[model samples]
Target: MTNSRQKIKKKQQDVVRFLEANKIEFEEVDITMSEEQRQWMYKNVPPEKKPTQGNPLPPQIFNGDRYCGDYDSFFESKESNTVFSFLGLKPRLASKAEP
Candidate 1:
């Protein structure tokens, strides 16, 4: 049977492949926080440290890009242009302006 760590690793590898095949560059962001650590931070950290509606935690800062959520969400958003930039991939520019 595969362990949780192994499962996570496989997911990461798949993400890498998807980005490569699509010619979409991306930097791997590690946001795997331990359950205990997260709980402690939530309980002990000052209110200011806690995330608010107007100010979100800056997406996990990687090489340079800001990834706001799980890999799947990141994969879907065009705003993830920053991720592609980090991977040294070119951005797909829209040819026409919206009406």
Candidate 2:
């Protein structure tokens, strides 16, 4: 696969892995399988978020009809420990594990 494709795949995997690890429910939409879904994603993404040259790529995060963000934003939130808020999810309560 091309480098771009590889990067996209890696990003998608990272997002999925994190969500799975945290037990967050998510729907993985494959735009390639349905043009309607693809168009809906493109349309839902804000104009400011879209690339200047072409349509936005996959792995776009959302909460129902609410637009969360793209991979870059997701990564940023992850790094800053705010991914739950970024995903529009309430953070889970801490369990008693000596902390």
Candidate 3:
């Protein structure tokens, strides 16, 4: 089985191809990094194993802050509620519930 990074890379490639075929204008960002480099950057990185059910998505860095999202937006946004829903989690409520 391919790692999450590898899987995302493949999907990116597919998107690029689809865009090119349709004459869409876009820029492709290559965020691929070596395993050693990733380890040096992040401590306690998990091994590249097959993803399991309910496995939390990876961490993301945005505007100098670290956040976690679902596999879809994990590498993109830190403010997306879709990520929370994807992980079977609910957004926190601001007001307390009344009994």
Candidate 4:
């Protein structure tokens, strides 16, 4: 594999590992294998969310149809409930309440 491909693959793996550690389920889409998805992501996701020069490539995270930024943004959200809130989820499973 080319150097670029290896780098991208590693980034993807890092993000996936983060999700798993946080108990967040996600779907992985290898854009190189799907041009339709690539076009859709670039079109649907706002330009501001696009990667600037020298930043990481794809492997972006989305909440349903909404863009949730990249891996750095995910970790940055540690100070707030944005991550769980964006995913429409609670940080961790809560105990059952008494009737």
Candidate 5:
């Protein structure tokens, strides 16, 4: 496979790892090579929400019917602990261990 493909695959794996580690269940889809899904995305998603890439890649997320951006946005949400709230899950409270 090409370097770009390798990179995309790695990113995809990383995102899955993060979700699993957090005990968050998610669905994965590969639209990179799916013309049918691409057409569906073009129609269902707003143009701005779509990536500016050649083939708008996968990892496109949706909470019910609302688009939640891509993996990058997902990561951002995870980092900020916003994903938990976004998914209607209780945010984990940080343990206050005396240092």
Candidate 6:
């Protein structure tokens, strides 16, 4: 695989890992296999979010019909400890330990 393809695959895997770890339910669509689904994703993505040249890449996330953004946004949310919110999920309460 090409370097860019490898990076995309890694990013997709990372997103899946985080979602699974947090027990978030999501559907994975393989655009390469389904042109219709790929077109749907392209149309659903906000115009501002779409690339100027090519169609938007994979790992495009959504909560139901709501767009949650791509890998970079996901990584940012993870770093900021706001992934649950980013995924349109209610934040889980942090448990307190007895002193």
Instruction: Write model 2 residue lDDT over 1-99, tens digit each, in one string.
Output: 479888988999999999999999889998989999999999999999999989999789999999999999999999999999999999888867895
Q: For candidate 3, write residues 1-99 as lDDT tens digits.
A: 889777766656654564466454554433344565344324332334215553322332222222222234533322453433433346445667788
Error of 1 at 28 (Å): 3.9
lDDT of 6 by residue, 1-99 (tens): 479889889999999998889887888888889889899899999999999999888789999889999889999999999998888999987769879
Cα-based TM-score, every candidate:
0.38, 0.91, 0.32, 0.69, 0.64, 0.89
Off by over 4 Å in 1: 29-65, 72-99
Worst ten in a row by lDDT for model 3: 60-69
Q: Rank the candidates by lDDT, best first.
A: 2, 6, 4, 5, 1, 3
lDDT of 4 by residue, 15-39 (tens): 7886788878789887778989887
Q: Compare the candidates by TM-score and give the number of the best one.
A: 2
lDDT of 3: 0.41
In the range 9-58, model 1's lDDT, one tens digit per residue, is 77577667767777654655443455653443344434654467533232
Query: Candidate 5, residues 54-98: lDDT per residue as tens digits?
Result: 545655666666676677877788789798765556777776988
Q: How many pairs of residues collide in model 4?
A: 0
Error of 3 at 28 (Å): 0.9
lDDT of each: 0.50, 0.94, 0.41, 0.72, 0.71, 0.90
Let me know the TM-score candidate 6 reaches against the reference structure.
0.89
What ranking of all candidate models by TM-score puts the best one first? 2, 6, 4, 5, 1, 3
Query: How does model 2 fare in lDDT?
Result: 0.94
Query: Which regions in candidate 3 have their CA more than 4 angstroms from the true location?
Result: 32-99
Scored against the true structure, residue 11 in model 1 reaches a CA lDDT of 58
Model 5, global lDDT: 0.71
User: Model 5, 55: alpha-carbon shift in Å?
Assistant: 4.1
Give candidate 2's total backbone clashes: 0
Off by over 4 Å in 2: 96-99
User: Which pairs clash in model 2?
Assistant: none
